[model samples]
Target chain A: MDLFAERGYAEVTVAEIAERAGLTKRTFFNHFTDKREVLFAGAKDFEDSVAKHLAEADDDLEPIEAALLALTEAGLALAQYGDYARARQELIASSTELRERNLIKMASLAVSIAEALVRRGVPPGRASLTAQAAVAVFTDAYAAWTERGATADFWNLMQQSLADLRRAVDAAPSRPSGA
Target chain B: MDLFAERGYAEVTVAEIAERAGLTKRTFFNHFTDKREVLFAGAKDFEDSVAKHLAEADDDLEPIEAALLALTEAGLALAQYGDYARARQELIASSTELRERNLIKMASLAVSIAEALVRRGVPPGRASLTAQAAVAVFTDAYAAWTERGATADFWNLMQQSLADLRRAVDAAPSRPSGA
Candidate 1:
């Protein structure tokens, strides 16, 4: 990330990154298949942990509640990497390809969470809608948190965003008088 | 779309499309910069119509409700193109590049709706969160409608999805007894 910040993502090469990190090219390849993966190496773990946490929520917990629990768990897991995450986001925002990759990554996480919810006995449609909504809110909140230089606790931001989501829904136009 | 369905998207050329449409290549270029643009030609109109309706919705309507009205209006505007829409979706699904383009397009629409909501006096945070959640549900509902061969009215699907979104939020774990 430091190299990416100094030299720009497009200008950097894997060999240089490996050398800068004091690791051999072979060792670097052993970890990430490509240079871009270096920045996203933790994403797979993030998805898995969130799914696990969501599935462990009480059986009676609603889909959205389970999703929030999962997101809070994952946010805590990622809290220590705030600076790194912020820098990585900057690098991604610099390139269209990176942005596409990041979008796909987040989409996959939403799908995984939905599937996890389904496995916990939520109806497929409800699970999917809840998961997508939760992920959308969580992603927005995370961005807001990072934009604030990560001073706010990620869980707090997630909860606030969740409330905002509910408030928005609650504000939907009321039904007209019966037909 | 027929050409794409018959020969596959990557196998078709702009010249062939122009010729099949009884238009000169120059005329085709005047309308669309590329073959992909032909499939997405209405997207700008979609954004404009939705924004217009959203801004016109009752001032008291919440950000999400306004967005829903806009979406329903836009969906109605595009309702006549069900077969074409489904075909275009199939073509897009066949290619990673197309899928990425579609995702970016949807993201931009969400951003535009959020901006419109802000212009209508919604706070920035609420506007963006509402816009995103609305888009997520709308996209899923549209997909479901298309999957069912468009037998269900798009507006109905939107309403059902909105209700599901509300249910999901309502089910969110109640705040623990006292903070």
Candidate 2:
């Protein structure tokens, strides 16, 4: 976020980033294809862990439960990166390019969730819808948990958000047609 | 979309866009502050229609009903631009910068919904949650409706998606303790 605020994403060179990190240019490339990647660095690991956890979860659990379980488990992993997460969030907020990259990463992960379901025998259309909804729940939970500060555990907050999603979707009666 | 794909957002130059539209650059600037606005050209009017429709909507309607009603009504406004909408989607997908711009627009609209509800006397947190949920429903339904060739009307698909969300949420016979 500092680099962006100081010089803008378009203007900052990868070499400058490497020099600042006290790392060689080759080392930087070895870690990330470009500076923009620092924003999305750990997403794949999150996705993989979520998928792995869900695969081992009980089959009787509904897709939403299964998804939330995965999200909670992923949140546990991110617990060590609280400050890093905040900084990354700021970086995404700082640039339009980064935000788009973040969305695409999210959309792609949602697709992965859907595909995982399909491989496990979920209907394709249902898979897509369920996956999207799960992603929605996870996203809402993550956002709520991220900014909740020191009083909350990320995993616990995610669980609450999942519960909130349940109440919002189920307990609230569907709106009448006119409204 | 054509203009953007051909010349890129920054390189397109607003003056050239004005000429293409047979208007002066001054008129273009009067309409938008920058090139990104052109890509989201329809968003403002769409939001206006939604806000207006939502404001006049029956209070008794459930949240899903309220969301679908607004989406369906807005979808009609966008129907004529089906091809254009698809093109815009493509452009946004192809460019991270444009996608982030789109997310900010979405975030703004979500906040607008929350504010509108707060004015209507709903509690702040509930209003925000409901607004975010509404956006999520529209996003999933719109993606389904558009990606599948617009076979179903926008509102109908939204209703289906809402049902799908309900089922997804309720499918879990029981949530875990942490959940």
Query: Clashing pairs in model 2?
Result: A175-B62
Candidate 1 per-residue C-alpha lDDT over B72-131 given as tens digits, one digit per residue, 9 for 90 to 100 = 777776668888888878888897667766877788799999999999988988888889
Fraction of true contacts retained by every candidate, in order, equals 0.54, 0.32
Q: What DockQ number belongs to candidate 1?
A: 0.42
Task: Give DockQ for candidates 1 onward, in order.
Answer: 0.42, 0.35
Residue-level lDDT of model 1, residues A1-179, one tens digit each, is 77878989889888889999899889999988776778788889999999988877878777887788788777776768889888877789898667766777788788899999989988988888888888887887888888888888676677788888888777644542111
Which candidate's DockQ is highest?
A: 1
Candidate 2: regions farther than 4 A off: A1-15, A23-34, A90-97, A150-155, A171-179, B2-36, B90-101, B147-151, B173-179
Fraction of native Cα-Cα interface contacts (under 8 Å, chains A and B) also present in model 2:
0.32
**CA lDDT, candidate 1, residue A4:** 79
Query: Least accurate stretch of 10 residues (summed lDDT) in model 1 chain B?
Result: B170-179
Q: Which pairs clash in the backbone of model 1?
A: none
lDDT of 2 by residue, B61-175 (tens): 6554564576677667777777777767877777666766787677667777777667667666667667766776787787776777766666667777777766756663444
TM score of chain A per candidate: 0.85, 0.80
Cα error, residue B59 of model 1, in Å, equals 2.0
